[model samples]
Target: MRTTDFDYFLPEECIAQRPAKPRDSSRLLVFNRDDDHVEHRIFHQLPDYLNANDVLVLNETRVIPARLKAQKIPGGGRAEVLLLHRLGDMTWEVMVGGGGLKPGKKLQIINGPQAQIREDLGGPRRVIVFSEAITPMLDRLGEMPLPPYIHTPLEENSEYQTTFARHPGSAAAPTAGLHFTPNTIAAIEDKGVRIAKITLHVGLDTFVPVREDDPNKHPIHSEWCHVPLDVVQAIKTAKEAGGKVVAAGTTTVRALETAAHTSSHQNIPEFEGPTSLYILPGFDFRVVDAMLTNFHLPRSTLLMMVSAFASKEQILQLYKMATIEGYRFYSFGDAMLIL
Candidate 1:
């Protein structure tokens, strides 16, 4: 399919700048395939629609304060570095911004640890080695990197992070996970809806647009992910019980789908790897029965994945309706539940 097929018109005003006051207060748009109907509701009402036998899988991969400030050594000039992922101890794959950051350049990353550019990996990315492990100093030296479209600074950096964020790795937040609060989790659990956590360290795969016109020709970057044995068993139990295996976000869906890639023979998939699985329309999904996700950018892989879950035409119509109904869009925006 053409990338344009997934494109839509969205006004700049619709992009949400701030998160909802109470995380769970965001709006929710429910699309039910069974009834071919759409229902608009508040996010807190999420539990009311789910059953005790259902399993809700969430991405617990935490958002790290990855954006770092630095200066070129010898003669100083402003520089910036955004950590993508660690290559190894004291070494990271990062994007050194402000131009002129060439291989062998020494970058004095203030307040954290000293970082030296070792190699230019192209795509404006670099291989940088730090003087020490940077993890300990992230809280002191790093800042939350918001999307470029969101020009306004958030009141609290933690607002961009999910309540269940535990393993710090992602450069960007698994945005759909940002809508859930501790109270929402409690409500879902109170209904006997089983909750499982998987990790998929979100990466630049989110920021890179599918530039190729032919969507099939677009390359998808790999992201680290892990689905535990327990989670796999829970999903099997839900499927056997005729309960839905609901994914909390697209990352969760991707992680589960990666595991389920070879599940035609196995009852469940127990997987851990750097998954580059790209879901497009007509791709058969082995696991994910339902999903709760935020509205995505047009012509993005995200939009394509959702279209694969629902129909491309149906999702496009739903997006048009959402725009007409004045629903917020993108990360820190509202949500959509496909069931």
Candidate 2:
């Protein structure tokens, strides 16, 4: 499919620059595929729509402060780097910005602290070797890498992360999880709905645009995910008890599905590794009965993945409804629950 096929008009003002005052105060657009129904609701009312016999699978991956400002060696030219992911012990992949800086050049974050560019693989990426541990260097200089479309500067650092964020590795937050507060989580549990957690450290690739006309032609970036056997057992038990496997975010869906794909039995084994699984339309879902996700960018792989899980035509119609209803869009925006 052409990238344009997924296009839609979004008012620039609808892009959320900051999160809603109270986290759960954000708007919620409920999409019920079972009956072809749509409802405009608030995020706090989410549990009211959900039954007790559901399992909410959430991604616990936390967003790290990855954006860094630096300077070129000797020339002292200004430069900025966004850490994508660690490649190895000393090598790291980064997205650099600012005017032309040739390959084999070195960038110093602070005076006398330089990272040598080992190679330039083209695009916004380069392989660099820092003077010391990549973590420590990032700890010293990195700022939170907010999405490009968000116009306002991030005033408070903590707002970029979810209230329940525990694992600090992802470049981006599993935004759907951001809507839930500790009280809301307890409310969901008080209703008898079970909660489970999985980890998929989201990378900068989550924001990479779909450049291919055919969605299948897009190469998905590999992300590390861990699905513990305990989560697998919880989900299996929930399913056995006639409960729905509801994923809190796309990352949770990916991790659970990847586990089911490689599981020896019907349950996922505890393991840690990388997954490049690109979930588009026509893909049979072995796990995940429903999804709770945020409004996605137009023509993004995220839109395609959800369209694949639900009905494409239904998603498109709902998106049009959302736009008409003046719903906020993108990360730090409102949410949709496809049930």
Candidate 3:
């Protein structure tokens, strides 16, 4: 299908500039295909739709302060770098800004470390090798890398993170996980539902606009993900007990579904690798039974994936209702539970 097939009109005011005061206070829109039901509730009400036999899978990948500023050596020009992925102990694939920053050049972070451009990865990306392990200096030099569309400054660094974020590696947050709170998670567990964790470091490609007319022609970027053997076992146990597997976000769904792509043990595989799985409409969903996701941007790969999970027509209809009801949109926005 065409990329424009997923396009819709989202008002500027619908975009949330900051996170909800209390994370769990965010709104939730529930869509159930079983009875064509659509319900409005608070984010904490996530457990109301699931049963004791269900498993809520979440992405534990934490967002790093990947955005950095550097001074060009000799030239002393200002250069900005947004670290995308780590390649080695002191090397990274990054998006560089500031004109005349060709390969084989050098730059130094003020009161921090220095780096040399190894090669051009094209499209604003460059392979850069640092003089020292910049991890220790991150807290001092790095800022929370908020989305470009969000004009407001984040009052706290922890505001963009999920309560359960454990591993630090992502350029972006697994937004669906953002709405979750410790209390809400406890509520789900109290109801006898199991919670499992997977790691998929979100990439900047998530915010990239789909320029292709044909959705299939768009090349999806490979993001590092790891689904442990225990997660596989948890899903197996849940299914054997007649429970549903509900994913917290699209990233969680991608990690779970990609791991199941080459199953050797009863349709479940223990996966640890980078995945470029572009989930389009008609794609077979083997693992995730339901999903808790945020309202997505128009013509985005995320929108396409959710469209495949729930019917595109139904999603469009519910989205219209959401817009009319003044529901927030995007990363810091409200959520939708598709069951």
Candidate 4:
């Protein structure tokens, strides 16, 4: 489909600058694909829509402190480095901001190690070699790589992390999981809904828009993901019992579907490694039957994915309703549960 088909108007004021006071206190928009019915509800009431036989899949990828402040070694000019992926013990694929960050240029990370640009990957991206492994020093040297749209600083770094977050690798938070709290998780479990965790280390590419007029021609980047054997067994049991596979976010959906796609048999196998799966309209969804996700940006891949799950027209309509009804949008915004 044409990328322009996914475009919509989002008022600047509708964008949420910060998260809700209590995570579960955020709004949830429920949509039933079976009958095209819509309901407005609180995020904590999610269990009400789930069945005992359903398996809720969550992406447990944690957000890393990927943003770093640096200075040019000799000129002392300021620069910003955003870590996208680790290439080796002391090298990373990164996006740099500021001028003259060419290959061979050295940088001094503020209060951290020295780094040198080793290769150019076009545009703002560069391969950087650090004096030492920067992963160990991220806590002290890096800042939370919050989306550029979020102008206000977070009160606490934990606000950008999900309660289920365990593995540290993602450059961005899985916004859907950001709405869950301990109490919310307990409530869902109390309702007899079994929870399973998978991981898809989210990247800044998730926020990148499809520049191609034809979305099919867009070169979607691969992200490291893992669907463990236990998760596969959980899905098997849930499906065998006639329950739906409820994915917590698009990332989980990707991991599960990628696993299913890679399998030679009927059931999904344990899958690990980089997945370049791109879900568009007309994609055959073999794993995820339902999904809970946050509002996405206009023309963004996230929006396109949800549209593929539901429909382009219906998703746009719900987004408009949410906008008119004052539901927040973006990373710290409200959630949408499609069933």
* Candidate 2 lDDT by residue in tens digits, 24-92: 999998888889888899989889866777888888888888888888886889998888878887678
What C-alpha lDDT, on a 0 to 100 scale, does residue 62 get in candidate 3?
A: 90
lDDT of each: 0.91, 0.84, 0.91, 0.95
Kindly list the per-residue Cα lDDT of model 1 for residues 181-266, writing each as its tens digit: 89999999999999999999999669677999999999898999999999999999999998999999899999999998856765
Model 1, TM vs. native: 0.98
Model 3, global lDDT: 0.91
Write down the worst ten-residue block by lDDT for model 4: 261-270
Whole-structure CA lDDT of model 4: 0.95
Which candidate number maximizes TM-score? 4
> How well is each residue in 174-267 modelled by candidate 3, as lDDT tens digits?
9999988899999999999999999999999999879989989998989999999889988998999999999999999999999988675556
Which pairs, if any, clash in model 1? none
Clash statistics: count for each candidate: 0, 0, 0, 0
**Which one wins on lDDT?**
4
How far is 126's C-alpha from truth in model 2 (Å)? 1.0
In TM-score terms, candidate 4 sits at 0.99
User: Model 2: how large is the Cα RMSD against the reference?
Assistant: 1.7
